[model samples]
Target chain A: MRVLLVDDERELISALAERLEMRGIQTRWVTSGRQAIEAMAQDCFDLAVLDVRMPGMGGLELKHRLAQSCPRMKFIFLTAYGSEQAFDSVATDMGDDFYLVKPVDIQELMAKINLLAGKEDA
Target chain B: MNPAPRSLTMDALQFSGTVTAAFSHDFKNTLAIIKENTGLLVDLLAMAEKGRPLDPQRLATLAERIGRQVQRADRMTAELNRFAHSADLPEAQTDLGAMLEMAVVLSARPANLKRVGLEAVTAPPLWIATFPFGLQQLLYRCIALLLDRAGSGGRIVLEADDGRPPVALRVIARTAEDRIPAGETAPTPTPEMTGLAHALQIRLDWDAAAGGWRLTWRDVET
Candidate 1:
């Protein structure tokens, strides 16, 4: 599956993309909301993993912007701030399908991705 | 006689909680990076065992990244420790530069989200016996006030006047749109805010020349 990772940390997102690529998933990464928009213009991804808080633009705002342009793209929200409770109150068109906190366990992430891919195929 | 006002207590709790939360958030970011880097190392090792030769440089870079994150986490821990200990005393001999530096660091994440560049331009160690925690809160609020005005590409500078007695501190949170004409009346701070400043014994004023808020005090505390 093709995926895009959006986060401010250069090291974290690049390493995440590399790790996912090793698992046979096509992954692209960007550091900011602006770059994410620029990337979507050039490439398509089946899934997006976004950091909830980032400089300039946050994940929620980016999600809306991305959703407007690419409605079918599935999303997973990651944050270091707090629990999924932080997102529970926000009215999101895309609910936290697989909300994960920081220091995410890769195995669980892989399972969630498989679940998403299966949903897409079905 | 009535007891002292509770604004200090409430304000202290609110500011302390905010700073601690930000520090915890920053630590999470650092830890997340370390976790991802280590996971990468594991992936590389597992692949190498399956006939893929390991790239020494790649492994070294991963190690370096992990080291850098560890250092980042360490600094955050030290800063948080200092911040927590700041409330231990109502008045203490505090270094103004360190105080400004902490304010800059704590305000950085939120300012970045607002796309406002926040910096602390501090000189030598200006020492004063004052309420460290309240001073930090005052500094934080001042910075936040300017960040409110500073839009994208706007810069806010927090600085203490160098080589000046009764060292004045300032937060330049004004955007270009904030400047007023000479004949026009400048905006005044709300009475409630002024009361809080009075409680903190900080002389707060709008410095048109600095295009932000200027704060000076006589090392006084209740």
Candidate 2:
């Protein structure tokens, strides 16, 4: 499966992408939303994991843009401040797919990726 | 009763009131997460009782998450302790960059909830002699205000310069709101915020032009 990780924290993003790679997922990581968009233009990604906060351009706006530009790309938001209400607001188009909170368990993350990548249903 | 001293005392009380309220609210959220995690563990145990063996790996991951949350709670308590004690002393030498980083971390959790970015512009560490917690509290309140007024896609910029004495820290509120809040008829500074700058003997300047506010302070003579 092809995946792209966008997080402002470089170390965290690198570590996460490495973990995803170990599970046989091809991953591309970037620190900003703009970079993620650029990567999208260059190649196709089956999934996009976005950190909800960044300096230049943040995640929610990027999500909006991605929906318009690449409708098929699946999204999974990872944030330290994940809350039920916050998820509820974005639950329509991306209904409960995967909203992993920060310090995410690698196993759970892999399981979610499998589901989104259509390798596993649950 | 004469209103002069009463008003001053009332304002002081209000400042303290707000600080405590914010601190308690932060503590509540920390504890709430731990509560939910433990509840999930309890559910896992119940499932095991029904001949459904809980995944050992899942249990281990959950335990680690609980441990991490405990550490987060510890850090919050430590910060609260430092802030509480800061009220006792008049001044100290604190790294301005570190102070801003702390404020960013504390604010980011909530800001991330609304999808607003609370970030510090990466720069050299700036140090200044002042009440560390007071400055942090003041900046935090401003960020919180901006987040409330801003939309989901807004970003706050925080910059600090150590080269200049009374090191200048600039905060730009980029979110759009042409006028101040409705009930607040005047632009008078909050006494608590004003007194903090006054206590440091640093001039605090607030500019409302250009759709944002700028805060600059003069360092004390070494």
Candidate 3:
């Protein structure tokens, strides 16, 4: 599956993209929401993984923008905040599931990705 | 007359929570980087088992990356530890430069998040005897207000001048976009800023040399 990862932390996102590519998934990464939008305009991707907090535009805001632009794209949020309670208190309407805490286990993340992406396959 | 900080428990808690949350997020990111690097090492080992030779140099590089992240985490914890103990004594001694530097360091994550640069440009070591926690809290609040208004690529400079008795701390901000350029009627101080300054018994005024606030306090024992 083709995926796009957006995170302000360059090293974390770069390493994640490399690992995903190793697993035979087409992956591209960017460090900002502006760049992410630019990239989406350049290519088509099945899913976008975004870190929930960023400098200029946060993940939820970017998600709303991306969803408006690319209706078919899927999203999975990544946050350093581990607890569900803390995530809920983020002062936003991002209450939907499919958000993962940081230091994410690859197997668990991959499982969630498959579950989200698999629905389209069927 | 000094206001009792015990009466400002709610304000103090909020101030502490703000710094703690920022530090927690930073620590998590540091840990996440370490984990990702370790995963790469394991992947390399797995590839070696699959008959592709794992260059020792690649393993060494990953190990080095992990080491740097660990050191970063260590420095963060030490900063947090010092901050946590700041409230231990209502009054404590601290170097003016050191105090300003700590405020700059602590506010860095939040400043970076807003695409603002927070820096300390101090003259030299100037010892001051004062309520350290209250002063620190005041500094953070002022920096935060600036960060909120700062646009992308803006810079805020913190400078300290010790006149021996009354020390002046200047917070000067230069925004990429033209913001209230230094003079012609400065914006009125926010109520929150006024309250924080009053509670800490420090004077907060507009510093129009370029743009920003000037914080002054008297230290008889300096």
Candidate 4:
């Protein structure tokens, strides 16, 4: 499945992208929401893995903006905060199924991504 | 009528929350990088077990990157710890330069978000007896305001002057055009700014000619 990853942490996103690619998932990554928007303008993806708190445009806000153009694209939010309150606040606005907290388990993340893309058995 | 002291308490709490949240986010990013690098190593080892040729050079690079991130996390935690303890003593003798340096570090996340570069100029040792936490809060607010006004791709230079009768700290916005446009007066201080200045017992004024804000306070070390 094709995926787009957006995060401000360069090292984290690069390593995660490499791992996802190694697992045979086509993935592209950008370091900021602005960059992700620019990339989306040039290409399309089936799903987006986004970090909730970014510098310029945070993940939630970015997702709202991206939805305007690519209504079919799915989203999975990644956050560093694992607190219930934090999750509940965002989950209430966005869905709870697609959220993962860091340091995320790669296997779990892969499974979630596959499930979100409707390729659960894969 | 003067606002209740509770309002000042709430302001301090808000300031603390803001700084802690910024530091926590930074720490999490650092940890995430380390986790990914280590995971990559594990993946590589698993591949090697399957007869895939493992590049020792790549492994070494990953190890080095992990080590670097660890050190970065250490520094961030240290700064956070120091900031947390800033309130330990309500009032104490404080090193002005050191306090400003810490303020710059704590203010970095917001400054970066605004695409503003922050630089603290070297200043000689200047000791002042004051409310350490209050001073930090005041400095943070001033820096935040300056960052907002700095616009995108701007730079701010922070300087501490020790020789002056009333020691002064200056926040200058580096821009092509002067921070204060011609014939226009300096912007009035917001209520938050006024309250913080009163609490800290410092004079915060706009230095229109210098294109910045100057915070002046008499050294309490008689």
Candidate 5:
């Protein structure tokens, strides 16, 4: 399955992308919302993993922007500031299954991605 | 007591809470990077154990990257430590340049988000006796205001002017469009900020000619 990862934390995103790729999943990553937009323009992906609090366009905003063109793309948010209130607010708008707290378990993340894309048995 | 002082105290508490949240967010990001790198190393090791060829050079590079991230985390922690202790003392002698440097470091994440550059102008060391935490908050607010005005791809320079007794600390926007006219309504300081400045005898004003904001205070005689 192909995945696009977006985050301002370069090291975290790069490491996550490499780990995902190692697990036999196609992964592409960018450090900003703008880069993610550009990448989406050039290529398509089954899912997009995004950090909720990016500088310019945060994950929620980016997700909204991308929904216009890539309606089929699934989204999962990763955030370091994962308070219950914040999670509930996001869940109210995008549902609970689409969020993951930072320092995420790669296995869990993969399972979620697969589950979201209906590739859990893959 | 008066309600004004009570209100100011509440404002200070709110400011402290805000700064703490920001610092916590930064620390979490740092820890997240380290965690990911370590996790990747584990994955590589598992692969190696499963009879996959391991590139020694790649492992070395990954190790080096993790080391650098640890150092980065260390620096961030040191800054946070310093900031946490700032409130311990009500008033103290502080190096203006050093304080500004700390402010710049703390402001880095927000500035990056806005795509704004922050630079400290080279100047002789100047010391001031004041409420260090309050001063920090004042500087942070000013810098944040400037960054908002700067928009993306703009730069702001921190400068110091040596005066007779009171020295001037300036935040200058590098672009003309970012300049705030003297007559223009400047960003309003928080009530707590105003109280802190008033107590510390610091003057904050817009300098149209300099195209920036100036914070002036009397230097403490050591």
Candidate 6:
């Protein structure tokens, strides 16, 4: 499946992308929301994994824009904040079951991706 | 009649508290990143246990990055510790260069977040008998404001000089709001700025023509 990664933290984003690529997934990575929007204009991806607290354009705002542009593209938010309060607020707005915090087990993430991506395959 | 010292003392306390809270929040976030990195390593190990091959090179790099972050986190903690204890404190001999280095590191994260490069012009460690904590607080708040206003790919320069008879540190500004041309008296210190300067026994000058502000400690008796 194709994945798009967005994060201002270069190290984390690069590492995550490398890991995901190793798992046999096609991935494209961008550091900012603007870049992510531009990438979407150029090509479509199955999922967009975003960091929540990027500087200029935050993740939730980016999600809103992406939802409008690419309705079919799924989203998974990766944040350092583990508070339930933060999660609940984002979950209501995102309307998806794929919000995961940082340090998420790769296997669990893969399982969730398989489950979501399988909607088309099934 | 001398202005009541209590009011100045209270203001200093409040300023220190805000600074400490901000610094601690930053430190906490750094720790959180390190925690996440370690957790990722653990996941990689678990994957190896499950008969999946993991890249040794990536693991090594990740380990190195975590170590660097730990040292970064340690330095931030030390700054926070010193700042927290320096409430309405008297003047003491301080290494101006080291203090600026700490502030630069603390400010760099925000600058990097805003895509700004925070740079400091280093001089030899000039001995200044000043309340270093107050100076740090003043500098931190100003840099934070500048970084917030500075757009992506902007640059902020922090320089120290021995020219003011008493040591002086000037923060070179970037944004239109921060620009202060040189050789001019600094604008009146805001009440907040004045209060902080009062606590540190330093004088703050706003130089509009030079496009920056200067803090000097000339009056404090050694």
- DockQ of all candidate complexes: 0.81, 0.03, 0.76, 0.58, 0.67, 0.22
For all candidates in order, the CA lDDT equals: 0.81, 0.65, 0.80, 0.82, 0.79, 0.71
lDDT tens digits by residue: candidate 5, B1-222: 434544656766876787777777777787788889899899999999999999999889788888987887788788888988888888887878888787787677788777888888766778777778888877877887778666677777887786346677898776535544334456666566667677777888877667678888844443
| Per-residue lDDT of B82 in model 1 | 85
Two-way TM-score contest, 3 vs 4, winner: 3
lDDT of 4: 0.82
* Local error of candidate 2 at residue A8 (angstroms): 21
Error of 3 at A4 (Å): 0.4
TM-score of each: 0.90, 0.52, 0.91, 0.89, 0.89, 0.72
Better of 1 and 2 by DockQ: 1
Per-residue C-alpha lDDT of model 4 across residues B78-194, encoded as one tens digit per residue: 998999888998778888889889888989998877778788887887878778888888888777766656667776778887645777889777653434324545666667778
lDDT for model 6, on a 0 to 1 scale?
0.71
Q: Summarize candidate 5's per-residue lDDT along A19-82 as a digit string, tens digits.
A: 9999888999999999999999999988899998888888998998887889877899888774
Better of 3 and 6 by TM-score: 3
Where's the lowest-lDDT run of ten residues in candidate 6 chain B?
B176-185
lDDT of 3 by residue, A1-122 (tens): 78999999887888788777777778999999999999989998888899988998999899888888888888889998857678867736764447888987777878877887787697
Model 2: what TM-score?
0.52
Per-residue lDDT for B106-206 in model 3, tens only? 89888887888878887768877767787788788777767655557887778887555577788777776746444356656656567777766678998
For candidate 3 chain A, which ten residues in a row score worst on lDDT?
A88-97
| lDDT of candidate 4 at residue B4, scale 0 to 100 | 44
Instruction: In model 1, state the lDDT of residue A114.
Output: 93
Best by lDDT: 4
Q: Residues B1-106, candidate 6: write the lDDT tens digits.
A: 6454456556557656655545654554565456656766876898899999999997998899889878877887777666555544566777787778767865
Docking class of 4: medium
Candidates in order, interface RMSD in Å? 1.0, 9.7, 1.0, 1.5, 1.4, 4.0
Q: Which stretches of candidate 6 lie over 4 Å from their true place?
A: A18-26, A86-100, A105-122, B1-90, B148-150, B175-190
